[model samples]
Target chain A: MSAALFSPAAPGASPSASPGSPELRAQFPILARKVHKQPLIYLDNAATTQKPQCVIDALTHCYTHWNANVHRGVHLLSQEATEHYEGARKVVAQFIGAALPEEIVFVRGATEGINLVAQTLGRTQLSKGDEVLITGLEHHSNIVPWQMLCAERGATLRVCPITDAGELVPGAFDALLASRTKIAAFSWVSNALGTVNPVAAMCRAAKRAGAITLVDACQAVPHFAVNVQELDCDFLVFSGHKLYAPNGSGVLWGRKALLESMPPWQGGGDMIASVTFEGSTWNHVPHKFEAGTPDYPAVAGMATALQWLQAIGLQRVQAHEAALLAEATERISAIKGVRIIGTAAAKASVLSFVIDGVHPHDIGTILDRKGIAIRAGHHCAQPVMDRLGLAATARASFGVSNTSADIDALVEGIVAVQKLFGA
Target chain B: MSDLGDLYHDMILGHAKAPRNFGKLDPCDASALGHNPLCGDRIGVTLLLSQGRVTDVRFDGSGCAICTASASLMTEGVKGRTRAEIDTVFQRVHDLVTGKGDPEDPELGKLAVFGGVSEFPMRVKCATLPWHTLNAAFDNSNAPVSTE
Candidate 1:
């Protein structure tokens, strides 16, 4: 909780000289375990990050001390639970630089967050002949919801294409933006490829086009810092599990005016203010969106994860992960018959590649045998795969606890795969 | 219990490297597509069925090593066999891959190489996808078969 923990070189640091300091690795208990009789080298951070002991302890503490439904009872345990839940919202608001905590709504994860916006705000704003603009680099979560919304409202879903290097094509967004564009949604960083989109510039363009913007920050939030106020997007959403917190915990931050204007997506116990046999009134901004009993423990865990990241400082995390990614990219590219996907000039910490005469599933299986885990498939971005003319690619995404040694192991595993396939 | 060596045996690798009966069979009696949505592995099976017997078979698509090799070996195994005989072989192969039947069972023949697949629960579907597609082809069903 103190700024002192943000020091680049903490006291009693190991002299072994690892990019991800040994001290940081020690905080995650799973890193110490073995898989297949070998030390586990996890490289799938983009899918979901490993939780630190502090976050796990926070979940346990909340469940043990105040295991009650939030915001309903006047009992001490209920008050404590409500306080922790609301406190988590404030932490998320501050972490993402929202103007007020009331703008943040807790949900199951990024998928739910996007669906909520698509159903509520999209239903209210969209009509016939309107358009919902998205990019070709979006995950299925971002694409399907907009498609559903457009189909329901008789609107059109327009897609901006990406370059061969996986970057958004130059001037494609502007060309696609027209008077009919009602909402523009794109990912801040692609989960399949590491391409980092020009979010602020895109937001500015969307605003000028008289369109509301929603940024999928699930991949961006874990790798670096995000300030919604500076980006000036109308809404942003991210998941907690990708940030080293528990699953089923996430945040959807919208402009206060927009959240107040949209209707509640789901209806249940907590989202309603008053109820009669015939009708019901909705609660305030965030609570109106959060129906039923929330996952209070997960919220507390997410708050602890945010505080832990703050203590480490996102800038340091960004630097460490970038160094690892650079080393990985350089070493992996040197191998014969290996191709790197998504060669964007600007990217986050994801490394995706394909080897000649070898399928990604085979690569993943061989790597898993060596205790080096990576994702190998379309990664739920089939459109991106189709664009790249590939069935799938093997992806190794880095995290704060990853070191150069993990990258070395990955390179060795790739060599072994090539040998196995005789490529 | 399954090692990488056993999973990627020499036979599996050889068959995968140069798959047999790979291509579309034009003017065939029936054909069906098998898709594994989980890994995006797809394979199509086409055969010439006459008098309730498979005279010729061909399979073509993209898939992992296990899947590709399984489909290759299946094309060679199922040729010149009746539908009931092919079904019998499919049951034994299913048991062999699931570790329920003896690996040394004389009925398995070259399919014994897949005895290692049982160790990987996830790969079971990959090994069985071609057989499922073949079943669909016999029925002449146009709907694609998915190993969900």
Candidate 2:
């Protein structure tokens, strides 16, 4: 099939079309379920999204049909399995607008993807007195790996600050991109605050300063289209689960030259070209980074997820989520003592807020009683929380399947929490 | 959802709002930090041990009502108790929260507010965090204990 068949939408897709609806909601089996005798309103998409039925079917189909080890096997089942596995890579490449399928490396999710780059590229490229630039709004996954790399290399982690609105401070990236900066790794969207960074601009600044750049797109890919080529970053990463696929699948897309230059992250079977008694020759580019037996079933499911998103058209999905977020921000902000964090002029579908004198855990518990699933805590972005002067906040992130009614339910749940806590 | 009354009883809320022994314990011999990474709930337990007895046991941190209440009640229950006696109370509280001990166990007393924790399995960690910090403080272990 043409890769364009799975592209978001052509020019003719009507802008006024309703992006998400009850019909789209029906495609997800878990949405039909309930918690506490009420229907589940899943507003935790930033953490992980619910898988659609088609994605689940894709996983089942992989095990049912092509249930065999890939790459080296000569049998028909192995060939078919290998075909599906590599085909999934091609789908991911097309999904991200990668230059070649060889640029895509499959791993266990965005965490593993970031770790792979940090261990391999960071180990080789970084040295004493070098610097790795990051933002204050990064998830722990984006921050910790780089911190470890800096510690190992005797380099320092320089953080670009964010405004009180939770957006990256203007000109902070340019100020932090020193000549000794080795690589600048940043999240395309703040997982905690939903503050979308100007990734392309940041990447350009880093590149101009002679530093490599990596974009953590784990939060971005699920909500809208991400063309890696357009962003012009040396690397980009995202997890499959955030994109409505299975949990164990994630994509790490690096420039072909960078992947070839960086040593294989882990020593294993598929990543070796030839093993000598003395030393072994490493495999090429993407395969060099992807070690051990891959999660073939999850990759197959990820392909289906991309196709499903494209069929619905990501533009519409973006519109739908944007609408939900706008409505949520308005309604939640109207509540007394509820302060919305990350009030950037531009944001995605995540709405994080704090109610005066009410702990987020209490809010989460009350929301749970009403069958509303929202995330509470620092959201694995402790630095952001620290910067905001809060221990934690309640977050409601919308996905393509979410609707205005879900936000309404969340507001009602928050009201119930206020009543319970006397906030 | 079990009754919020069961989990967040009036006493639990009262303790959460006005936690007893809630401040720092200066001139303490042993202090340990317990953190629940799942919810970012952190509690610091500081014990001023005099002659092998907890002369002043205080905790300070941010967490849910269950966690704060448990820590507050723990300080109150362990004040002036010997190390051996505190361990016994800790064991009983753990059992009560895990649904393995008597709800009416008089030893728990006000600590019985945690008996409802078994109904919400996830909250057990919140209720038990301060207890773990207390044990860590007793052992003089500086490593921050985690409930994972």
Candidate 3:
């Protein structure tokens, strides 16, 4: 990599647009914490990211100042809460380049967002013998929901395979997009392997084949910019927690026409236009899908998270993570018996690896001793592990706050594991 | 942070590198697979039972050091023991790893190396995978048992 990649801006300095600025790390309070009497080196961004102080403050501000149920009351607290909540929706819509704010539906996380689509859109659009084409590189959330949709609708789920290098097998997706294919859902970035799938191309092909496309952008949204219009996907889902917001916050951005046509998957107080003992009419598009009392503070916090990320600039974050990934890949691969899994040409923040004699769980344990945090398992994408013929791999995924020093710490941790295993 | 010595004692690492009785038995009548869905540590335990005793026991699969070492030590502990004896050993090992069994239980012997497993709560599953699979094998349950 470049020498500039290793150098970070001085700590406690003003924010700079340049990659690996110390100001970026200063914004997150958790990054200052210690683990095991050592400075924490958190590299598990694919699981979730650390929230910046601004996002945390935004959550507290929402609860402290504007705590009220959204969109229902004509009272002042309710109106202020409603404004911020709807404001967050508009911000999310703009972040993803959705056609309208109504196209963005709030869900618990990417898992729930996907399940909403699978139940509402998939249930209505699919028929018996219809195939939902997903890739072999899906997290269980993406896989199981479609499986349930298929099982309930008498449809089938088909997978497009991946190569040994973890890239999608070329032309496999197109080959599987047969006449009966109904929906084609895939990840924009593989959470397990860090492979950045050719989502725009895949979505284009799926659309040409008359299939609705849903891009699981859970991993993608954190590391880089995602413009839904640019990708031209019918539906896209991402978790707010992965984007440096709190848990229980996520977005499912769909085309307005599609959301309009689909019936609400859930029934609750807020989702109804008119409710009787025996009958009910659904509310408007986005509200129709979001039922019950929403987490308004989380919604406000998610908006702040988006704004914080915007201030940092996604391009800078992408470059910063890419540099870290390159440094990690080079350093970790240089170690004997350490094989880096998922060598896709275009990967973002994730670096998955396995030592020849040491199990990933052991690697995780050893790393934890040195105050390093990483995910050690199939990464909820067991299908990817199954495809790679590995039970599990130790994964170190990057975030905006990570630096080359963190990567160095990770390398040292791996060396310690090798020594422990006598590899 | 956990102390590495407590979790991966020398004996555990040694047995992991070269586990004993690690292969499928040809004449095995009872066998069951155990899988740790969390880490994908799979252990296929094969038992050759004669009358009411486990005449021969073997296990084969891929797993972490704790799992492999536990399996290897268990083979030495369970061989030639009656089914009831094996059950007691299993219970003791389970209790020992979970920090609930008597450490001075003389029957534990070499198996006591895993007593440190309780220090790292997450690793208890890794240490106990083979024992659970052994139970399933003895019970003649074909379905894979999962340590979720």
Candidate 4:
């Protein structure tokens, strides 16, 4: 693809003006495709990001060259696979600013990462009358696992409420964090509303309240930088697909001492040090968490994706997406009878809104016909939706590859939807 | 683009905008609730039957345009029809939306406006949730039907 294809600049304008340069966008091959006979305009980045060629090539290379199990066999392929997998762990550790590579455990996604913590650490620490505190803005992935854990352990689940602007109510976390709160978990960036929580403050408060903290950085990691040490959270998790890697690839970064102290959630081949009919000893911290065969290729691809983002620099990606979000919010808000949801003072690139008379599904369908893909639903965060008194909202989430032109197309699509519905 | 127009036909849009019989029926003989968990669309169907015929029917809920319009059209189509007749009509409507039944089938009447829904497979559930709730209501099943 030509550099001009990805350029946000108009004809004869300089391409260097945008953060998502033509060079960056060209690396994503799928961006060249069409949908419904129109150029594909992907605005559903919050769902999953389109992969760059480097990440795709890495996946194919792993399978083609050294398709073998890791940390088991002494053969050449096995050794090579083991090296690649371990090397990817190192890259992930650095990407998220982990103190040690062993702290980075490979999981299917952020959902599994949270479940691992809830089942292992939660099962051990939580007692009857103990509480698990979460925010109203968490996705279902963050909410359901804790609910299951609380049910089994006879623990109470507390929720910190958010405001009409989709931010956590001031002092709500402090109010909810009691001495009996065993764990405090929340998303660094909300998937449904794009609200960026005060993670550092929340973590400190939780620590002072004698609660273990877990940060769901699935949305934050892709848009910006996340350092576990700086945040001082006990555990942090993110999915690779949202970072332009393969699906079923993720990282769970926990404090090394805490991970070592907690028992493994699942047990199988790689997670065991030795097994007898009567008893078994578990492997090290990460391997104990990674049961059976891991998706080594996916891990390798995730590493490549992290490297790709690192090379581009996340600050630039953040700035670019912020611009897109501002543009979308300004344009969409100007339309009569349109209401923007989640009007938080601080947010990421997700722009969710509702029309006065049109349902979100209709807006999604109309946009789909125009080859503009936007998410329209509760975003698996039904509580957030219910808290806001909405069934669903039309969400247009920006990614690195997106441009101002895409936002213009989305605006036009929304206008067409309103006209069709006579709203 | 014209295909989108066909899918959101004037009849469908009209019904979605101002749905007919769009409120709860008090003291109904049989009632059933339908939910599409994927999109959080809910449709509660209430009907009064006499001599195996639907004497009165009303629906109350909020959902996407297709779902709301489907429920509105369904209430109109099922009134005065017996259980067996309603079953046959539902099957025809189902086939019509799923792209199996003939679009020009005279038996379908105004319900044929949904013929375009077949092109969008994901929307088949939206167009059928009301019908499923209607079936459940006829059977007097208290359990809420879900299109997962």
lDDT of 4 by residue, A323-398 (tens): 9899889999999989999999899989999998898988998899999999999999999999999999999999
lDDT per residue as tens, model 1, A1-423: 222211223234331233378877887789999988889999999999998777777777776677788998989888878888888888899999999999999999999999999999999999999999999999999999999999999999999999999999999998899998999999999999999999999999999999999999999999899999899999999999999888989999999999999999999999999999899999999999999999989988898888788778888889888888899999999999999999999999899999999999999999998999999999999999999998899999999899889988999999999888888
Give the top-scoring candidate (DockQ): 4
Query: What TM-score should be assigned to candidate 1?
Result: 0.97
lDDT leader: 1
Which pairs of residues collide in model 2?
none
Give DockQ: model 4: 0.87
Q: Which DockQ value does candidate 2 get? A: 0.60
lDDT per residue, candidate 2, A248-268, as tens digits? 999899999999888888998
Relative to the unseen true structure, what is the C-alpha lDDT of residue A227 in candidate 3, on a scale of 0 to 100?
Answer: 96
Flag regions of model 1 displaced more than 4 Å.
A1-19
Better of 1 and 4 by DockQ: 4
Question: Distance (Å) between predicted and true CA of A107, model 1?
Answer: 0.6
Clashing residue pair totals per candidate (backbone < 3 A): 0, 0, 0, 0
Candidate 3 C-alpha lDDT tens digits along A136-183 = 989999999999999999999999999999999999999999889999
Write the number of the candidate with greater DockQ, choosing between 2 and 3. Answer: 3
lDDT of 2 by residue, B14-118 (tens): 898889999888878999999998888999999998899888988998998889989999999998899899889989988988899998999788988888888
Worst 10 residues of 1 chain B by lDDT: B1-10
Docking class of 1: medium
